[model samples]
Target: MSRVKFELPADDLTRATAFYREVFGWETQRLPFEYVLVDTDGEPVDPADADGGISPRTRFVQGPVLIIEVPDVDEVAGKVAAAGGELLNAKERVGEYGFSQYVKDSEGTVLCLWQSIADGTAAV
Candidate 1:
């Protein structure tokens, strides 16, 4: 089955991080490019267990996104387009992590596709 990863939009990283940290006791890690990673607990998410990561809102990401992990981003993207969905952004490499892309399903809901690297350290 395809894995589902949830993403919440954050307009203010500092404020959002603090809120989650205080309210939920979640730990936050600031990645390069001003993106903040939120862990529900202090422990790092096991690659085999994680559903997704939290980050700041981007131009292509206006609201919450559900990232679905796949084996091949390009193939899935083509399938999305062929199924009457539209690609919101081209596939992008997240450093050594993996490749990802955004798409709007037939219902106009924005979703993300994540393809992990060989090391399995990719972010969704």
Candidate 2:
């Protein structure tokens, strides 16, 4: 399971939901602020179980991006810069739980790096 997730941009939640529904066959459920949860088709995961659910603990940003995990954020941050992708933010610890950062690809698309409590490492 990946520690990271992606949220696509939407100008109109209902219109976007309908489009994605036809395009990907994914069911979107509304939350607050016109945000929708992209429904997964597999068995519903329970957050109470260790490896059964989405990390209810991690924070997610609202935008279309890739989620990656890595062992050390500082190391990856350097690599991102060296690779010509600009690092948008330094790694930030969210309490004792995990850390995250933002970066932009060569085309300027933003991507997020996610680290979780389980491995204390960021996902790539």
Candidate 3:
């Protein structure tokens, strides 16, 4: 699609933000509710094309799980299972913005699947 955003889990927001900023030179914004937004200053690239020293083979489970936009969370979740992957949880509403679900591929790399809900209604 056009854009993709990644969500990283951190126990210490301050420390994590500082680490990214100091180590990688990424600009970070401390948002409300202890959420620190990291600006990578570049579009999301495929692991295969990334040259930040992370091997593409382990990139899926190494750090931040990639968030890919999809049209239907449920449909993609079903496809994931059919393709030998496992869903970590059922699709759920994302604060009226969309629905999301965590899934692990056959290689055990967890990623998030997101589907936007245009009408603000929960999608079945």
Candidate 4:
């Protein structure tokens, strides 16, 4: 299994975090520097079995952004572009927080690539 996950980037981590906390009532865990983790509870989901009990109506779970834990942001950036995706931003340090970049998928939908330098782990 691939350790992939999705992350929603913000121009201002503090402000975005606060806005989400108040508006969505989400729990935020401050990591090193300005990086923070939005706490969420994951539950089993099956679109085909919507009538089953695993649905949200039956099992209440926190459905957050689908974060893909990638390996190399730089390499993936190339793959993304070559695969019909466009690089919106080059890989750069996220201040003292970590490293991040942006890209637009084939459909022109922008997304973020997250990398945690502290632990040497990455996500995109």
Candidate 5:
């Protein structure tokens, strides 16, 4: 089954991580490029949990975006326009681990699709 994750933008990493820690009991770890990974379930973070990254608020993402894992980024992306959604950008490599792309649904909700490196298909 496909896994779903959420990505949220934060203005402050230190404060944001601290708030999530204190309020939701979620644990967070700092990542390279000033991103933070939040473990909403309190589980020890796995090495491949890059989808949970909380990045600084940016022009493309001023709010929360859902990250859905798929088997193939290009295949799903090809259906966006026909489904009445707009492809925000083409898929780009995420550290040799996966590819990520942004899209906007018919209802205007922005989302990110992630295709992870296959272990024949890795667990989320």
Candidate 6:
């Protein structure tokens, strides 16, 4: 099964959150950042599932972005442009869990590539 991380862009998170809860029956948890995680499943937000987040729409990121797990972000980051895609940012650490990068696909849809560290707790 492929692991996916998704992000939803919202102008007002509180209102958007209500919609997610009432319409989709999903719960949300707010992180330290302005980001809110949407638990599509009633269970804890498992990494194996399509864990998603919602945040205020940004200037560059106005639409939803989907993330796919990769073995090596740097390796994949190198091939984006040749594939007619654009790397929006360089790979960066997510605390001690993993690294992520945002890239725009050939048709301009922004996506993320994630590479997790097996020994997750060690800081890079």
Candidate order by TM-score, decreasing, is: 5, 1, 6, 3, 4, 2
Query: How far does residue 98 in candidate 1 sit from its true spot (Å)?
Result: 0.8
The C-alpha lDDT values of all candidates are 0.78, 0.58, 0.64, 0.53, 0.80, 0.77
Error of 6 at 35 (Å): 1.5
Q: Write the per-residue lDDT of candidate 4 for residues 26-123, one digit (tens) a residue.
A: 66665545455654432232221111111111011122233333456787788889999988766877554456676777986665565555553544
* Model 1 per-residue lDDT tens digits across residues 1-124: 6778777778887887788778887766666665555567567655444545667788878888998989889989999999999999889997656788999999999999988796866444
Stretch of 10 with least lDDT, candidate 5:
115-124
Give the residue spans of candidate 6 off by over 4 A.
Answer: 47-50, 121-124
Show pairs that collide, candidate 3.
none
Model 1 is weakest, by summed lDDT over 10 consecutive residues, at 45-54
How many residue pairs in model 4 have overlapping backbones? Answer: 8
Off by over 4 Å in 5: 49-51, 119-124
Q: Candidate 4 — which residues are off by over 4 angstroms? A: 1-25, 29-36, 41-67, 120-124
Clashes by residue pair, model 1: none
Tens-digit lDDT track of model 3 for 27-117? 6655333445455654443332221211122333357777777888888889999999999887867554567788998898898887767
lDDT of prediction 5: 0.80
Q: Which model, 2 or 6, shows the larger lDDT?
A: 6
- Over 65-101, each residue of candidate 2 has an lDDT whose tens digit, in order, gives 6756665677777888988898887787754345778
lDDT tens digits, residues 1-124, model 6? 4477788899998898898989988878766666677888866654434378787897656888887888888777788878889999877886545787889889988888877777765344
Least accurate 10 contiguous residues by lDDT in model 6: 42-51
Scored by lDDT, model 1 comes in at 0.78
Backbone clashes in model 1: 0
User: Candidate 5, TM-score vs. the true structure?
Assistant: 0.85
Best by TM-score: 5
